[model samples]
Target chain A: MSDPDRVLLCYCTCPNPASAQHLAETLVRESLAACVNRIAGIQSTYRWKGEVTSDSEELLLIKTTAGQFEALKERLLAVHPYELPELIAVPVERGHAAYLEWVRAAGGD
Target chain B: MSDPDRVLLCYCTCPNPASAQHLAETLVRESLAACVNRIAGIQSTYRWKGEVTSDSEELLLIKTTAGQFEALKERLLAVHPYELPELIAVPVERGHAAYLEWVRAAGGD
Candidate 1:
């Protein structure tokens, strides 16, 4: 079914590991995400406020189903520390069936 | 344009940072991807060969347009160390117009 493929891998960046871990735990505890992978040692380069900027940031890869996206985004915005956090969703095209099911179940279906 | 929206954020895991850096550089130099973010300290848990397995792996968040996905996958497969690597693609739903354009241009669009 398309349901599993509709699972999303959401990406966001945090200023530090503490905030990143806090957000990740909250999302998983609230069932907004099945799992959240916190990645450290990421150097991001981008343009901000008319200037080219770069930062050492932690990245959060949040996994949840499409149906939960809106709620997840709302919660993320409410707690995220950034003025304009990078909240991007990408569809999971394929994966192991059991693992995908585990993700769905973790997101509280 | 739709082309920019068609940009992808491909995710994969490598055994170590050296392999990850090698792949990332190769992808960029070959124009298969606009950028690749290497994140260390990733803990991946999944079922493998009838058992659940976990590993500390480096995650590669690869950015490229949709058109380059096939070639990128092919190149990745040819060089990846895993017997069955996790090659997943997620469509970028939204991003800064300028940044998205930069990604497309980097992918050789």
Candidate 2:
């Protein structure tokens, strides 16, 4: 299997559907990403300002290469409404050759 | 030094927050994961019925050992309202010794 480039997996969440869709399409259409998988129905529990809080949020798993990450972050923040967009990147170790190829074809610089 | 059993990563989403939290708790309370990191703001796109469709989904990265996966899958489905819960398991190659140790300690049969 042709090893896929170690993908940078980014995570994010939105309170409303419009912002979620908007960010996803913008990332994909611009070719900064090979693919963008949006997931919803997240109940988040965490400490904010030293107080425990819980909220319903939608999470996004973004797939891109390491090279484009900085720019991707900039783009996400430019449009994202949240005070702190959950932008974390993980490395893709391996994947089915065909699937990774599809990702590469889908990506744009 | 101890080796943490290779973890199984399961991805999921809930249309509503209740389902998300409910499913998460069931899995964790039963000790299916060392930890469940909840995130939000996801916008997903995929092809369904020959048409490209998109929606918001909260992807749950359920961290557990490889052995508990079968049971984990069963429990997630039992509590999950979705027809097909997005349950995909990926292996952990390496991790910090202390963190993996916590995972092992957190596991339950």
Candidate 3:
């Protein structure tokens, strides 16, 4: 099981700005994320179904607490356009204390 | 100690396109990173030195292996202009297998 209070930076990619924006808003509105940074115009290259595919995708850096990850993942997989969306959570080992505390509180219980 | 073979996503921010591009190129060229995705025009808000600050910055999503992290961190701190640059390494628990392999191989031993 994931830790309940650890700060996490979850990385997710969307096909375009519309989807990215929608997802970001949903996460924040639901208090599943403290904040979401949308970075547009990223080119991703990876292997898919035995072929190397490259495409333009927008990246979402979602900030939340670990306890929210499961719910966040569920919401993402349910609403995301991709059949298999990438949701990778990386722990925040060190960050500004005040900022991290804000994230934990803003992320909700 | 970190797991040397694990794939890692290192989050970093640059003040502008020139710096972001330069840092990305250097990391890839030096094998400190397998790939670096430059996302321009991001706004970051955080608490710094007892004050809350917000700034427009470019984000660098660096892909490398844990083995290269220390060297990568050293290089980033040495070259990054900020008195204290943010270098957060998030371990990749899951990824496309081939892509992860590419990262580990390209990141060097």
Candidate 1 docking: what grade?
A: incorrect
> How many pairs of residues collide in model 1?
0
lDDT of 3: 0.81
Alpha-carbon error at B99 in model 2, in Å?
Answer: 12
Worst 10 residues of 3 chain A by lDDT: A45-54
Chain A only: TM-score of every candidate? 0.92, 0.85, 0.95
B75 Cα displacement, candidate 3 (Å): 17
Top-scoring candidate (DockQ): 1
Q: Tens-digit lDDT track for model 2 on A67-104? A: 67777889999989989878887655433344445555
Best by lDDT: 3
The Cα error of candidate 3 at residue A8, in Å, is 0.7
Pairwise lDDT winner, candidates 1 and 2:
1
Tens-digit per-residue lDDT, A1-109, candidate 1: 2453378878888889999999999999999899999878785544334343446789898999887787888898889898667677777778999999888888674
Clashes of 3: 0
Sequence-dependent TM-score of model 1: 0.59
Taking all chains together, each candidate's TM-score versus the true structure is 0.59, 0.55, 0.60
Alpha-carbon lDDT, every model: 0.78, 0.67, 0.81
| Candidate 1, Cα interface RMSD | 4.6
What is each candidate's DockQ, to 2 decimals? Answer: 0.22, 0.17, 0.19
Q: Which is the better candidate, 1 or 3, if ranked by lDDT?
A: 3
